[model samples]
Each structure stands twice: as C-alpha cells, then as structure tokens.
Target: MTIDTSDGTPAASPDRPATPKTTPKKTLRPRNRKAQIITVAREQFGRSGYHNVSMEGIASAVGITAGALYRHFPNKQELLAQAMLDGSSSILAILDEVDRTDSKVVFTALVRYGLDNNFRSLLFDQEARNLTPERRTEARAGVREVTSRVAAALRHERPDLSVPDSVVLGWALTSIAFSPARHRTTLPRKRFEALLARLFDVVRTAPALPEEPAAQPQPTSNFSHTSRRESLMGAAITLFDQRGYRSVTMDDIGSAAGVPSSSIYTHFGSKAEVLQAILARGNETLRLGLVQALRNADSREDAIARVVHSYTNSVISPDSAIAILIEETANLPEEAQASTHIAQREYIDEWVHLLGNETADARATVLATISMINDLTRVRLESRQCAIEDLAVRILATQTV
Candidate 1:
C-alpha cells in the first residue's frame, strides 16, 4: 500500500525511479493544525496584501496541501476574517489575565503582547478592508473590544480625562505599542520595550483634552470641476478611498465625474493610470510640505517639529489623497509601485537624516512614530480632533529619546 505524507505528497514506490533503501521521512502533522494555519495566514496576509496572496501560497507555507487548507477555511475571505478575529480573541484572552484597572499594568501587558504578536494589529487595519461588510464589522468588533478595555483602564488611572479623550489615548497607546510591526526595528528587545513604555508615559501625562471645536468648512477649490481631467482624477480618488482600488471601476469613476465611461479613456488610459496620477499628486504635496517646513524652520529642532506638524495635518485632514497614497499604491503597476515606494522611502530618510541618527534603530523608531501618528488619527472620524495632532507632533518630536 502507498503511504501518504502529512504534507499530502505520496511516498516514493517501486514505480518511481529506483532509489537506495532508506526510511521514509516522518512528517509530524501537529494536532493543532488549525492554530498553525491561522498563524501562518496572518503573517502572509500582513506581509503581502490580501489580494496578492493566494490560498495555495498560504497552504504551502503551512506545510499542508491546498485541500487541507480548504478543510480549515472555505475561502480566502474566511481566512482573512478568521485570522483577524482569532488574533483579536488572543488579545482579549491576554486582557482577561491582567489587572485591567491599573493603566500601567495594562499598558505593560499590552506592550509585551504587541511585541510578541506584532502582526495582529496590522492585519486589523489593512487586510480587514478586504472582507465583506458583515465580516469586516465582526472582525473589527473584536478590535473595538480591545480598545475599549484599554480606554477604561486609562479612565481608572486618570479621572480628569473625558470619555472621548480617554478613548483617544487608549487608541494612541495601542497604536504606539504595535507600531514596531510596521517597520524593521533592530533595537534590543528590552530597549524597544523601554521605548514603548516611555511613549505611554508621554501620553499618560498629557494634558486633558479640550472640548472639540466646531467643524471647519473645507476650502473651496479654485477650479472645481472646471477641467475634465482634474474632475475625473478627483472622482477616482474618492471612490478608491471609500472602496478599495480593486473594487472601484472605470465606469464608476466616469459616472462620478459626469462623463461617459468610454470618455474616461480620453484623459486617462486606464484605472491604473488614474491611481498613479492620484499618488503622484500626493507625493508632490509631501515634497512641498518638506520644502516649506525646512524653509520656515528657525533651527534643526524647529524643522523637525514643523515637519511632524505638516505630516500630521496631511494625515488628519478630510482629504482622501493621503489615504489612497498610503493604501492603494500596492495595486499600481510594478514600475509605478517602485516609484511611489522610492518617494516614500526618501521622505522618511529626510526625517532620519534630520535627526542625525543613521542607525537602524533610529530609522525604525522614526518609522514607528510616523506610522503610529497616521494610524491613530485615521482610525476614527472623530479622532480628527486637534488634540490628536498635538499628541502626534509630541510623539515624533521625541525621536531623540
């Protein structure tokens, strides 16, 4: 009888090429294959975006056949949803053990957990967007539960903060803690943990948030829809931001811009070109911000502060261009993706060079600071409060620490 290996490959037999007599290699299929599948799926999904990864790729990584993977997950969507939900559940389990009342105790536990399982928070942000509306909501509900627990702990520690402020701080803490996952941080594990602890302290002692001011009116475009090409670009960005780039169609863009779908070709060759245009505009905006920040700064310290504020303003504003620049670039064609990535890297390098710390750890810390600020401010629409921007500058300006 032919024996099958745990990896779903059949053992070599006489019908195959003759071979020297040897024992068949043992494949230990772990009893907890489901857990292992989820773990591998999370890493793959986080490293490569949801659309880029395939079930076969994930199964191969997990040392199982595609058939075996299917037994655990019905489709890629289920894997995406379950991986995040399971990750959140793991965090919830950790929260259950800690003293959730003491903010310090809770913060320490969360930081340690985040360091160990860094990818969980990232999947919650980018990959969850690929899920169906109901699945996405279910996955996010788990994250909200984790956030609320931390916010409650903050309230217990500091009573002066309003409910909204505490919740904001809660999210800030979580974002800061898990930010290392977004970059390659080469810091000694202990030192990195200490850095996170200090950042939590920074937020912990921050002044109580003030009442939210009235919503400011957006600036009117000087040439609003006067040009067909510009109008199509604007419509494409909004659609891509609200839905993902893959889900938005050329027809959708044309309809939103008040043009015939075929007429979209007159201005833009394809959807990819439209996306490339939107990202190009965003890159130019950042370049200009950097220039202005440098030109107006009184000193090196002032330059860093100015840059941080400039970036925070770009991220916190209602404009969808920044969001598209950040999230949708992955869908661009290979050459376009490379160009966008190079621009983004150079932008970060400017800040690192400004800090005069070229070490890997410094770059990693700066990256985490920028990513934490962007993520914390964008998680909730209400999180656009000016106080969050202040906190963001505070976080990045402390890179010397």
Candidate 2:
C-alpha cells in the first residue's frame, strides 16, 4: 500500500510498479525516499508546531502507512529528529553559500530568498525536539552551531552594537525575521522603509531608551462570534503562553478551554491539537490584521499605522498566538513544524501580494517588509515594548519615500 508523505504528497511504492512492470534488477536508492519525507515533514512541523502532529499523520501524508514508515524510522520521534537533521543541513548550505562574501547584499538576498520561499526558516527558527532522546540531543547540538554562525554574521554587520552574539540579542534579531509584526504587515514597501529610516535616526540621535513601555491594550471582548473549538483554542493559548506548552497537560487545556477533554478528541485528538490550533489561529489573526489595516487606511501613511496597531496588539499585548508560536520553537516534531511554516508563509506572501503582484519590486518589497517585522519584533523582545501607531507610521513613511 502507498503511504502519503506528511505534506499531502504521494510517494510511489518502491517494491513494485503500478503497471505490473517487473524491474526486479533495480537497486533501491534511499536518497529519493529520504528527500521526499524531509520535504513533507518540514511542511508539517512549520504549520502545526511539535506536539500537535503524529507519525501516523506524517506517514499518511507521504502516501505510506505508518507501518511502512517504520521501515525508514524506528518511530515517530525518530522521523521528527531526522527531519530536523535534514532541514538543518539545508540551512547550512545557505550559510555556506555566503560565508565567503562580506556583501550585505548576499545576506539580504539570502533573507529575501528565505521569506519568499519559507525554506531557510526551516533552519533558523525550528521546533525540532519531538524526536527521541538519542536523536534530539544530536539535533539540538547541530541547531546551536547553525545559530551561532548566523549570529556571528549579524554581529559582523553590527560591530558597533554592544550585545554579544548567541545571546538574547542574537535570538531577538533572529526572532524578528521569523515572527510577524504589525507595522511590517500593513504598509507598502516604500513607506515601510521611511518608517525604518526615521526609527534609525532616533536610535542614533537619541540620548536614552524610551522611558515608557509600549501601551497596554484592553482584554479581548469579541468572543461573541467565537466557536466552542475557538474558545478552547483561545483559552489554550492563554494557558499555554502562561505555563509553557510541555508543562501544561491535556487535562489543563480541557479545563481552561471549558470544553470537556473529550471534546478535544472530537475537535482535535490531543493537547497537541490544541497547540496547532493556537499556531494556526495566530497566523489567521495576523492575516485578518493586514486586511483590516488595508480597509481602515485612509492613505498610504494610515495603512502602515493600522498594520502596526494589529501586529503590536498581537505580539505585545498577551494575545494567544505570539507567545505560543515562540514557545513551540524548541519542541516541534517534523510533521507539525512544516505545516506551521507553510501557514506563516501564506501570510507573508499576502503581504508580498499587497505590494502589488506585478510590481517589479514585489519580491524586494516583501523581503523588506519582512525585514521590518524582524526589526519591530526585535524591539518587543529586547525592550519588551513597542509603540503600535508610531512604529507602523514610521515603516509606512520609509517605504513610501
């Protein structure tokens, strides 16, 4: 029987041909199968995170039964851990590509390529600990080295900055590139640049950090339209973000969501299901935020402000998805990680599309927009604050200019 890979792609059975053509003399090559599973597994993990997916689910996606998958991996954890290994290798290739070059252009191009394709993200910001202990240790070791190299590159560019590489500052910069932010989400590329330029002027010219923390928002009151599933998800986000995903059990999620734990079986089979729900919901909210910003924007300038308002609201204000996404960074398995990445890509692509699909600068605009989000997230993670309206306006003005 043929098993589907985790990404919904079919993998042809190697033992036999569909047409009944006997090629018994053929030597089986493992590379082809390994590559196929890697692709599917990455898609699953990126979209779902770690705890939310199953090996059986991944096997089904690959067009193979879970029993069939056992031929390749000892168990689900092995599959996930190996997927992380393969994904990290792909990233190392990208880093190696530019290791010889000092040009920021190459760095920018690499970042641009990553945002456009969502491939590099598999490397720099993964949640791959769902693997078995033996494999997980190996995977984490590799991840640390890869991150160290990336951090070194960033530090190379910003030699003037006081923060050291591989620490909170480094993690913060990497976080910006991967996380979605408001000001970056709403405005056109030209206007967004203006916003960045203005911010830099202030950063370079100012004598001290801003005195106040970013503004606090009111708690959500729009549950009127939310479903039981969504309520569970929303409640789960609050709890998961507060207590951490692994520490919180399925029972806690069920109790907090006010749904019978069994309802989770109906809506989502496990606590992991609830986790994926939070990740997916975060992506959806960001998408909706962009749409709302566009609708509310009276001018190019205003558009950026609306986006900033949405992004800031989501990340800084105790929203469900933001912390959930970050928390999942170290614990996702192959199937869950890839799926989450694809979902986030779809959102970023929408931003790219917003820059005008046929525009010559569309890709650059999207990457630049992505870069802005990275910067905005940097502020939030480092200082733990952001000015929603101000950040959005600055990004919009820069891009417009």
Candidate 3:
C-alpha cells in the first residue's frame, strides 16, 4: 500500500517507485581560482619548503578540492615554477617602466616591489632547486635577466664599476630589499620602506670589491684523522647544497662519503637525522663565534667590526654551512625546526644587541646584512670578503629615514 512519508512524499509500495529528491549542486571553486591557487602556493612554498608542502594542503588553503587544483597545476613543481616565473615577470615589468638613469626612481620602485613580494626571495633561492631541470633552467634565465637589467641600471649610475661588480652589487641590493623574507620584522610599512631606501643609497656608495686575497694555507691540525661521523656530515651538506635535500638519498650520501649505505645507519638514523646533525653543528659554530667576537672586542665599534668580519669569513668559506642552514631547515622534524629557529633568533638578537639599538629597524638591518652575505656566498658569486664586510657595516650603520 502507498503511505505518506515524514516530508509528505509518498512512500514506495510494491507497485510504486520512490521519487528521487533533486538538489542544486554547489560550486566550490572561485572564478579567479587559478590566480588564487598561485598566490597561496607561493605563500605556503615560501613558508615551508617545496617538498614539505602538499597539493592537498594548497588546495585546502585555496578553499577548493585537490582535483580542482590539479586542473590548474598538474603538480607542485609546476606551481613552483609558475610562482617564480610570475615573480620574475613582475619585477622585470617594474624595471621596464622606470628610467634606468634615475637612481631614485629605480630604488623606490624596487623597494616597494620587494616589500610587496617578500616571499619571492626565499622561494627563488631555497626552493627553486626542486623544480624539474627544464623548469629550473627557465627560472634561472629569468633571474639572470633581472640581475642583468639591474646591473645595467647600476652601471649607468656608477660609470666606473665593472660588469661583475655591478652584478654583485645588484645581488646585494636584491638581497637587502628582500631581506625581510629571511626573518620576520615588526616595523610598520612606511618605516620599512624608508629603511630600505636608505640601504639602497648605502649600496650605491659602497666601495668596489677589493681584489680577492690569495688563498692562505690552513694551519695543520695535530689530529690528522677525521671522524667517520664528521666526514659523513660534511659529505651530506655538500650534496644537500648541490642537490635539494629531497633529491638526495641516504645511499647518495654514503657513496659520497665512500662508505656503504648500511654504514650510514650506524652513524645516523636516517637522512633527516644527518640533516639535523649538520644544522645543529652549524648553529653551535655560529654561537661560539658570536661569543668570541663579543669577548675579543677592544671597543664597541671594534666588536661590531670583528663580528661582521668573522661572519663574512665563515659564510664565504668552502662548503659553508650557512647555505644548507637556510635552505634545508624546513625539512627537519618539527621539534628540530622549532629549536633551530629559536637558536637562529637568539643569534640575530645578539647581533641586534651588539648594534646598540633594540629597535625594529636595527633588527631588520642586521637581518638584511646577514641575508645579503649568505645569499652572495651561497651562489658562489662573489667572495670578496673585505668588500662584503664593508657593505655589511655600511648597511648596519645606516640611520632610519
């Protein structure tokens, strides 16, 4: 028999078919979802390393399904490549408008762009290694083009500087302008922009890189034998610096160290453990050097100079730990990431303290100086220690506008 159901629909009987209720399907993706996805992807990739971020997380952040995101970007690599290329295009576009001869116009526009796109610097340096070789080349060409244009502009301003020096200075400016991405800063927008503008002048007037010093022989250590664990850590960082951490394998590390893959487990639990150990050692070295730099100072100015020089030396050294520290920290286990970050902050705080101003601008300046040194050193672009140190000191000594 037919009977009425709770909602007044007729219940199905042996001879009656049930009525199917129809509801309108809700649309989940936004009309501008493609651009939205790229924006959020850049933010997440910059905040966390590329391998550490997931397509699902990106989709969720964009308020869409994974399938929808895939429609826009097939994989995370494409998203990274797109994000970097987009940034490159944006910067290049800005340069296209400004008069290359007008230093103020060039600096003003660039600082504004840097503040707006702070994350691009981090993604450009630390995460681009994860891209496919073809995409990496494409992204690299974009970066080189930006560097070339900026160098050309700088050369117009300073007629005496060589192409190499102008490129190096261009990198310094880019690094300083984007330095806030390396660490968080609390300065308000206007103040930050002014600070960067002042730094632009600092870069403009800084002396040309002095001739590179001759390589001096290292003093012989009493202990000739290197520990297996130490050797393993050294090999791993070199590999990590060359290839992104995810691309490297435990077997690759072991082979580089001239040991079997099984031997690595005896020294370290996993590839992650090896990375953690390397970062930990790097942090310790930085702290000890900081303490010594402070302890040996004859005066306040002397202390600042000593610290700057020592840091420049360490950062530019062969297979420097600074690169891996910046790039691979996101790959460490969560607890390790927290501790390492705290230590890094403490290190920066010490520098800020030494600078004798606890203001946000001072902290930002110190961060910028450190980032500029690290960026230049990591790329192996220009290792002129005295020149870098001079520029660093000038950056630190700039008054807020």
Which of the numbered candidates is closest to the native, going by highest TM-score? 3
Estimate the TM-score for candidate 2: 0.51
Where is model 1 more than 4 Å wrong at Cα? 1-29, 120-124, 210-223, 299-302, 356-361, 381-384
Runs in model 2 deviating more than 4 A are 1-24, 47-68, 100-120, 123-147, 164-234, 239-251, 257-306, 319-398
The digit string of per-residue lDDT tens for model 3 on 211-275 reads 67888998977774467787788889889987889889998888898877767889999998999
Q: For residues 152-223, write the lDDT of model 2, one tens digit per residue.
A: 654565565444322333333333333222123444545434433343343222222223465679697754
Give the alpha-carbon lDDT of every model.
Answer: 0.79, 0.56, 0.80
TM of each candidate vs. truth: 0.85, 0.51, 0.86
Error of 1 at 205 (Å): 1.6
On a 0 to 1 TM-score scale, where does candidate 3 land against the true structure?
Answer: 0.86
Clashing pairs in 1: none
Once superposed on the true structure, which residue ranges of model 3 sit more than 4 Å away at CA? 1-31, 122-124, 215-226, 399-401
Error of 3 at 316 (Å): 2.4
Q: Summing lDDT over every window of 10 consecutive residues in candidate 3, give the lowest-scoring window.
A: 117-126
Which has the higher TM-score value, candidate number 1 or candidate number 2? 1
